[model samples]
Target: MPTEKQPVNFIESALETLLIEQNALKILSTQIDDRFSQACEIILQCKGRVVVTGMGKSGHIGRKIAATFASTGTPSFFMHPGEAGHGDLGMLVRGDVLIAISNSGKSDEIMMLMPLVKHLGVPLITMSADDSGPMPKNADVALTLGHLQEACPLGLAPTSSTTATLALGDALAIALLEARGFTADDFARSHPAGALGKRLLLHVEHIMHQAEELPKVFPDTPLNEVLYEITDKRLGMTTVVDHENTLLGIFTDGDLRRLLDKEQQFNVHTPVSAVMTKNPSTIKAGMRAVEALQSLRDKKINQFVVVDDENKVIGVISMHDLISAGV
Candidate 1:
């Protein structure tokens, strides 16, 4: 068999593509001017949702852009122009904003939607390489993202152009995000199922072990009894509570080690209160899990007593819990 020509170096090819994309992005960045601001203003003033549309690869990027906008305080959704021609255009309302993506600015599918979009009095924003094309001429605001050669040796594939378009979409979304004064908490609210949301929105109450699951003993309980509760609960610690079940203090594995180092016999009957740290660091059930984790780190503690507004012990949360949740 003829030896196969050495495989085209895939890694080298990929690096070259990335370098081309970077240069393309730089060119697009320098082109950002008053038109970009005008696009942001149009989207900001839109009373209805943003409807993004395109064909082929541009369609995929448009869908992602729509999602980013939706999750970042801008109400948006993707509309396939082909689907729109087939009755999906009914989804567009009078006040909605339309963002049409086409590298060449002459996609037949996008051009087909322009008249309807105009008739509805919706603002049309076109992202295209050609500023003079029909789509740009019809659009209320044209975002010209072009002037870069493709990375493909064939020069037919949309390699650098798509990258530039994606970056331009990001810049637009971020500008709108800042203009809306969107914060991490606001982003977390929109993405409650994601890791960042878990860190920012989840609270001690949502994860802490409560009621009978809490390892607790009266302050007067013997140290051995406190150890028994700790072992039975498997939290490596136990809370010392008052008669009304209010948190008085906490004892942990660290405290046990210190006691052992002090030569205290395991059988010695010391009061649990004597071995516990009074008013140990605690967190409220409603506090954000991320804030709780920060408190734990700042105080150098592994466990926190979850309490109610009245200072009654509700539950306990460990550093391991936050870590397990990827917070």
Candidate 2:
């Protein structure tokens, strides 16, 4: 028979763990000395990509650090130390920077790879608790993460040490990102498949309804004809333009609803210009889709006209298009 599990106080346990990690992070902050600056300098000076490597728990942290660097405009990748001793060592080049992570500073796999890394004339940066450890002594710049007791009751698991290492890695990555003048658009290019990239990289031109697909009406067009354009284009709105196709105003579902609610009798022969909102919200074709979305959200409106420098309607954008494009 399977053993019956007792109900554990999970929330309390989680809080305690968080408190311990917070304390550990506070301790780690005090040790940011000259070594940290040295590491940053080495990375900033590198012409080639950053190569991160470690063993076990440190390996996991190294992978995250490599990913953060890569996404933030720094070209970087993680190399397994054990595998590096095999043919993987070929990945390291002369101008590259190597970041080795080990809390104990005695990981044999890392030590074995250090000489080959040195022989390749690459700069090495090490993160370890012991400044005198073999890896740190061999490195050109040593960032000491310092000693913080594990949050684990037994003091055996990685715990606080890994957390400190990860934090230090994040600090390095972000600092370098700012130094390199990395922008949101640059980050989006690296992460093109995700929602963040869609928000940063997508523009009005990519999602707006253009040409004949846009719901538009001439100023002299009948009010009922404008209704037909709105229904046919299915954007819940239509733009009013003049003889030159210059945007004049917009008529939306809200406007129609209000008109109907007020019981206003409209002559079918009347022009739409009489009731449309003049100089409606407009966006440029090159504007980011995310910015357009925010504009619509702020105004509590669902549609905007994409206009040229002369204020001529080039296209139309809607909340539905932004949603469908994952912006």
Candidate 3:
């Protein structure tokens, strides 16, 4: 601890810590050998969840690793080793796989639960600094983090070791994700309220204005009436359809501005079809909202006329609507 009497270089200290941890992660990458693949193989064949257990700082990292696995298609959860010694050992079932994290490979709390875990026939996977300790000796697959040089000035704290462990955990989780052929859509199903979920799961029809809420007009409708429809709907645009409700074109507020600039004598009584944009890009009602947003960005357009398979107008989807829907 630096006092007011001594000058401290905070930037230098932080940079040193980061560099040390980064090197530890680099070393950890090389340590990924046959044992890593064996662990993944065991997990891939598991019929039950992955139960993660650790103590102290390792516990915190274990929880995060378990969460990543859970969200990425693998079923996983964390169990406190200390708590497992009491009644929580029941959480470990026969088909489940156990991932024990202990930098020293000899956490007393974790070692105490090994007998019960083994009796349940759970395949043990251990992460530690090396494969020399009891935890790794008993594991079905021992993932060694290599020899890490701690960033702590006293070399008493777990710095580089924990960072390397986290990196190794992420590597393992992603390997399983790829092996399982997990997709973005699959990930979205597990996170329906997240941004990615909204983008993938929310469709055009879910957020589009339909029925009377859509601003639509016949091709022969007067320009002034089209502006009224646009304002009434507050969508900044209106679809121009024929008598059969088959979309012919679209008219927007921007068209009004350009019409004013081009025509010396503007006539609000003129047919909107004469000034409307012909064959505007349209989207199906079932299309994903994110696809609509991508189209908007690609074509430099703000909205789409939602149409059916027969090109009949069903609804209208706007950029504002997509944004509001959290797509």
Candidate 4:
């Protein structure tokens, strides 16, 4: 026999679930009070890594929290509770801080390891709902997610609780990051493969053309020769420098166009300095590539001479160079 077709409101149910989870996080925000500060203090004072543990869905969240903390200035790692009993418990040592998560404030795997954790003198921090349980009572500091229900319609799946827990974990990691005075440079050191790291760590000197690659000409160099330098270098501009290579001005393709528009006959024998733009914008070789890109945009220009402290032209940087390098 065929069963009657069931009618369902999937959109309404999804929106309701989002509302439930949203409220849980709002509640979680209010719960970041004294206990949260105390937990930060404990981790700050610890002389070793943070060891996070949880079971099932909580375990999954714990792994991410551990990764966030480790990347954001705190040294941390995640250990599965099931593995802890089988011998991973050795990963925790005296002076280390352990973070255990369970919505019910108790999980048999965590409970089984609690005694050994205590015996090893590891400070325990438990993240859970405020349910009376040994894990909460015995923890050095208990970060309660407070009384809350899952976003799941039947309240059987871990949804709102996990969201709240993840938020709390992020809050803790960022707080520690601020307390430690972590800077972008510090972050880049830990995340060298990320785009942000590249932006902060890369400099003009690392990418700018140097030495003979610079399209340069003497201030009195003939316009025809200057054209050769620009075309050969393919940078669309040629720097005008004196005998000591001190920058005097810049002659670009734009200048050539304007010159031709005004003059009936282009004179190849004219001095390069006669048509060059004097005191052209320049950038130091040590400036960050991203900073250089912003300067290019702000000045409404596409190229800059890489100059030294004495205003001597050393190299050139172009918009194409930065863009091609993913700056």
TM-score of every model versus the real structure = 0.88, 0.93, 0.93, 0.94
Residue range 1-327, candidate 2, lDDT tens digits: 999998989898888888988987888898888878888888888899999999999999999999999998789999999999989999999999999999988899989887778789899898987688899899888887777878888999999899999999999999889999998878888877788878888999998999989888998888888889999998899989888989999988899888878766867677888888998989999999999999999999888899999998899998889988988
lDDT against the true structure, each candidate = 0.90, 0.89, 0.92, 0.91
lDDT winner between candidates 1 and 4? 4
Choose the strongest candidate by TM-score. Answer: 4
For candidate 3, the TM-score is 0.93
> Against the true structure, what is every candidate's RMSD?
3.0, 2.8, 2.2, 1.8
* Tens digit of per-residue lDDT, candidate 1, span 1-327: 998888799999999998998999988988799999999999999999999999999999999999999999999999999999999999899999999999888999889887888799999999998698888999988998768989998999888998899889999999999999999889988988878778878888888988788998998888877878989999999988898988899999899999899875765578887778898888888888888888899988898998888899999999999888778
lDDT of 3 by residue, 70-142 (tens): 9998899999999988899899999999999999999999999888888989999999999999999999999
Q: Which candidate should be chosen as best, given lDDT against the real structure?
A: 3
Off by over 4 Å in 4: 1-6
Q: Where does candidate 4 clash, by residue pair?
A: none
lDDT of 1 at 179: 98
Query: What residue runs in model 3 are displaced by over 4 Å at the alpha carbon?
Result: 1-6, 194-196
